[model samples]
Target: MIILKYIFKFYIPCILLITAVTVVLCVRKPYKKQTVNRVVFNERYFRKISGTEKEKYLDSIVTSLNDERNDSVSRDLYLKAGEEYYYLNNIRKSFTSSQIALNLSREAKDSSRIAKSLYFIGDCYENSQKDSAYYYYLQAQKIYTLINDYEKLGRMHFNKAYVLFYDGNFVECEIELTKGLNYLKNSDNEKLLYSCNTLMGNCLEKLFMYEQALKYHQYALGNLKEMKKNNLDSDEVNNFNVSSVINICNLYDLKGEYSKSIKELNAVLTKDLKKKWPRLYANVLSNLAYSKMKNKEYKNVEFMFLESLRIVDSLDYRSDAIYKKIYLGEFYLAQKDTLMSLKTLKEAYRSAVEMKNTNEILRTLRLLTKIDNRKKVFYANRYIDMIDSINSIRSKISNKYARIEYETITVEDENKILTKKNFYILIFSFAAFLILLSIFGFVYLKYKNKELKFVKQQQNDSDEIYQLLSEQNEIINKAKEEEKNKIARELHDGVMNKLYGVRMNLGFFNTKLDDKSIEKRKEYILELQNIENEIRTISHDLSRDSFLEGSDFNTLLSNLIANQKGLSRARFKYIIEENFDWEQVQNIYKINVYRIIQEAVLNIHKYSRALNAEVKIQLSEDKILKLSILDDGIGFDINTVKKGIGLSNIKERANSLKGNLDILSGIGKGTEIIVMFDITR
Candidate 1:
């Protein structure tokens, strides 16, 4: 009555608006861009429609939109039509419409629509062909993941898990169900959550985790109970509630709590389960009887089992009948009727083998092997072969699932470019051209200002370095002046005195041509050689290279390390290659190199906390001047390290010389800063 009232309430208003909407739609453009979201003139109103008349109405709109003339509009309409058809239980048309939508979406290269289409198609295939359903679900899942559509992604997971559960891949089913719960827990997907939790419980029960399975089943029951009647059908909720009770009862029985199992089972028996769902009615009867037998409440247990078996057989549920038979076999064996138990079990085993039910077959085989000693070896061999085959099948299925589920998808990055037909517009758009030109000019000027500011700052840093170098040069010039004066004094005091004595001796030898005078002349020549040696030493000092090369460069590096070694606890090592000729480089390049090394050493001393440091300067035969500063200390993450003046100066100097600089560091991994200046550059 309520559903009829709802339909009447909505139908009259829609009937009143039909003519007006049709007139407007006929006059208006049917396939505009925004019309896709709207899908049809009355799409928003039909979103919750459930009546057969509304379904026909939606089908008519889809048929009329066969020549919509817009790819995206057609795709959207088809996808919406697919959804509507699905809710109306039109499986064939739903699959066909969704397939059309997928083709159109792919033609337009629409990723989200393609995923949506696949989801509907998978839903259509879920019952008919489970493997095909899983394949589509996996494809849809990857696309949903790529698009970050979590709700749909979670739905896909539950769908795939449902397939795996039915296929008896319980462990993998449990894994997927857990993931589904995580994704849907905070969402308004109570129904899917209930279903996945139920399956997860079933998986745990199959895995022999009785307590855990009981917890999940309870959680599923809670979800169903807490859900609103409008969100979930009352009858459906009642069905799930009774199903949860049956599961809980079985689990309790398995855990050796038969009293609790019987109590819960009795609670749901008041529902009209026998008439509404005879299958579940049979299951409850079977579970209750089994629990009673286990609890030693043997009265009426056999009658209850026979009644459940009668219902199962009437329904033609082979698996359920076989299970009831096995339960009867166990009951008879407990009552010491060995012949009847063996006969009942053999019947179960024969049917299970015929049906290819591995779980039941194993159950039957185990009991037969335990009691039927004459055929024990045969049952044992069959059980072993079955176990081996199951193992092999499970291994292959797991590998196949991994390959399908974990495969990476590469989405296209291509964009559809609109064809340019307005050739005159580009030529005649003088105002737009001016606007673009103005934007370019503004950007260029702004960039130029930043560049000028950076250059000015660099120049200032270079000036500071130049001033320091100049001060050092002044001190060296002063020392050179002092040395020159000392050399002049040495010439006047030592060399001139020796020369005067030699001249006097020579003059004496000129006056007397005797043998004693000749001996004195030989002594005068020896004194001249000594004065020549003193003059050569002073000239060598005057002619020493002032440019930073060889010993000069070595002196600079030593002084830098010597200066920093006291401020830091770092033990410094400087390695200078033997064939490195610094004179081939110019003063400006050499100055930058010196400043780079100096700043790097200063930074290391301040922040490196290094126990050992190495400064290696080498020049390869190809004229690549390499400077490396290494330290064994706590390093820094380059992405996070704040560049201070010392490091900045090193970078600026290296940049000025057109060098490639690399500062490699990691926390506790030490730091290595390398700069290589290509002399060719």
Candidate 2:
């Protein structure tokens, strides 16, 4: 029994110890195998390689690092691979590598590396997916700013501005360029300084601020010239000089100095430069042609345009090619070759529609309208619709720019205050360390409180803006409803009554006709019946909301008058200025203008007992919409008569639209209402 007890105690303990040791050793064996299989890469050797060799070296490093369990080293290797792929112009691969690196960096909680990876991803998508690129760039900018990497943050802003510029968001691009310039002002990075100025010039040019654009372009040119004189003869420097010269030429063109622009472009058309920079060369040629066309140098204009077209075609520069085609069409139109103009413009229009090029589409539509009166209304309506879309996009871009600018300024102010406090704490630390700590603690608490207040104020501002937009939308909806009600009343009262009168006249004719005269009377009765049918059709069209859905204010006014003709005894005459692009006006402004006119006409129909009324919509040279409604009706005294609901609604809508309204009325005289609103605002 004693031997059995010893066996149980000693043998059981030894067996349990053996099992635990064996289990641990088995786990350690796999770990050792993993260590043996893992490969180490030499980054220095990869850096030493060049060209294809360097790319291959990077690939090797990536392959080796993929199996490594160390996230930091793997992320660094992926970043290197991404850079190599970017240099090779393998954008998809570059994006994939950067995405992997971004994931790793996020897992590691390394904000700086994550920012870098995001920037790389942005670069990869810069040309293909601009909105995505802009988003990534903004993400990187926020992180870089938070980490106090001003240089990278400045670059990020510039990159974002580039995407905005390409997307035709000039106002936002201008804002970003301004921010980048501020960040890089004290920096010694001459390359970035030149890029910022160049982009700023381009944005200003697009915004039609010609003088500012010229100044910036000239400044950039001067910088490049100085650099050239200082023996900076690199390809990048040369490219900058060429680009700056092109910008100056474009500015001159915009400023109406056609001769000077032509001269500048001519000087840029050197054979060597053209060979080295085909795209720039083509653009210069195209601009030279346009300048020549403006200067009325008609002989060589076509030749220059054709040459630019050929160059761009060979280079597969789709946007440039499209621009050249449009220019060619315009040239044909100016030369009075209607056949050729229509042909080229039609082709260009189709291409522009396919490309969704808003500018080109509007230009082509305008030219086509001038050539073909048959399709004038159709093309004009399309052009106006596109203009509204472009304006909306610009408005959104402007709002975004304002928000980004506000946020950037707020953050910068906070950073400056924090930096100042830190400087003070360091300065006081040696003299009184405890006092420094107390001061820092107090400053920190104060900063936190101020930050909270600032955040609250920002939230309040945002809410106010949202409320204002909501109110505008509500006003627009109410105006549309008022318009619909007025149309319904007109259709029911005027058109139906007119049709009933026609039917009664026809019935009387049928009763009065004898058998011998029946054939002649039947002809007259048939004419009366046709008139009734026409009125019914007109009433049906007016009843549908889609008939009044035209974006052009003038077109909508025309439709309104047509519907009113059968309903009202008063003759409505409308005069709209020809040169105005009514599409440039905001939808809310258009709706308000439309409702005001509609209400005034209804009021005249109800009580004016007028014979004639005139409605005029004109756009002034200063970008203001001027509206006038006059009726030769028995007018009431302004001081004695209380305003009705119609008049009150008109006045309220005008006020909400930021317009000035003037009412002139006197007893036994006509009534006239004039409204003026600034469209530019």
Candidate 1 clashing pairs? none
In model 1, the runs with Cα more than 4 Å from the true position are 1-94, 108-112, 124-132, 228-231, 408-681
Candidate 2: C-alpha RMSD to true structure equals 19.2
Q: Residues 381-471, candidate 1: write the lDDT tens digits.
A: 8887898998888777765656654442322211111223232243224224344434443344457768997999999999999999999
TM-scores vs. true structure, each candidate: 0.50, 0.54
lDDT of model number 2: 0.77
Output the TM-score of candidate 1. 0.50
Best candidate per lDDT, number? Answer: 1
Q: Global lDDT of each model?
A: 0.78, 0.77
Indicate which candidate wins on TM-score: 2
Model 2 misplacement above 4 A: 1-58, 68-76, 106-111, 127-131, 226-233, 391-681
Worst 10-residue stretch by lDDT in candidate 1? 410-419
User: On a 0 to 100 scale, what is the lDDT of residue 302 in model 1?
Assistant: 93
